[model samples]
Target: MTGREFLEPDSPQQRLYLDGLKRIEIMQKILNELPKADQNLCYQGSYFLAANASLCGLAANHFFRNILHVRKAAIVSALPMAVIPFLSTAAVYDVFVREPLFSGQLNCEVCAVVRGGLVGAVVGGLYPVFLALPLTASLAARYSSSPLPGKENLLRFWLSVSQPVFRKMSWAVLVQVLTGLYLATKHHGIYVKILQQMNTSRDPEELKA
Candidate 1:
């Protein structure tokens, strides 16, 4: 069935299938038709996102162990650290890469910079609320920093929440903006190499298609 036709169906199953198909369509276009320069940025953005998330997660985990004196099983702590930042990265990446490139606005230097700055501001502003809060709360609770008798929970909450955000927010936003500029400006040397690797690595039959 045509993807468009699939989308018109009211059945939940049809909707789910349509969603998957839409994602596949989008990915194929991105991988195949996007300019080498933009494609490179996407690859770098993904790598940068992973690296940034790892750093933030590690720092948060370190705080729990060193400052709070709470140690968690390696896997238990590592999973959330990996998952949370990647989630935020997905949105930032969309703003930095997909939104501009897909809309054809990224070809112009001024538009790209404007879009990047605006998106970075938004992503940075929300870092504390979205990224920091849950991470802080989780780490704080993991260390069992519950309120003591005669002490308000508010104080503990404020301290845990503020510290991480204050330490990371500016850095994170700067990374986001720099990423946008890099993707928009950097040479496609790495991107070309990555595509060549993918092409060489694909199965013969798949590559033929």
Candidate 2:
């Protein structure tokens, strides 16, 4: 039978064909409501995030063991200080830079770079402070007669301890921003191709044929 003739209501496969069409329609509706970039860009962005985060973690481990003369056993515990910032930075880049760029909201290369840099700087600056909290608290407990320092003193101490972490993570942040910018540019053309392919695949005429 011809393609359209096979879809006749009296045919044995009619119910299955209709069900498949309904499922496709539902999927198309969902895709229409969501951002186009979410199709492929999100996966690409996640891969970039995960790979960079892993690299940053390894680098941090090395830095702690070699540069800071930290014990190998202790270096493992301190990895969050190195890895968290990159993860957070990557998250920010995916949300602010990748989505917008691929979605066509962000068209300028300079804009993407600036946004990525800003995201890196902000996350890099703040994440270390939070990551250092446990270390700072442990240090305070170990070194001081008091279990906890006063709020002002604790704040000051946290900053001091976190400074080194921040410095190391600054390099990670820079790398992440550069990587984000590079990927954004690289995927721009790819994004268009993906959308075209998806559209062609979902064409009702093609499905009917």
List TM-scores for all candidates, in order: 0.51, 0.48
User: Which portions of model 2 miss their true places by more than 4 Å?
Assistant: 1-42, 54-91, 124-129, 135-152, 192-209
Computed on alpha carbons, the lDDT of every model, listed in order, comes to: 0.52, 0.56
Residue-level lDDT of model 2, residues 123-157, one tens digit each, is: 54444445555543553455452344478787875
Q: Candidate 1's residue-wise lDDT over 76-175, tens digit each? A: 6666666665666557666565555544334555555555555444443334234534554565576676432225666775676456655655576566
lDDT of 1: 0.52
List ranges where model 1 is wrong by over 4 Å. Answer: 1-38, 42-44, 105-108, 117-133, 142-157, 168-173, 186-209
What residue pairs clash in candidate 2, if any at all?
A: none
Number of clashing residue pairs, candidate 2? 0
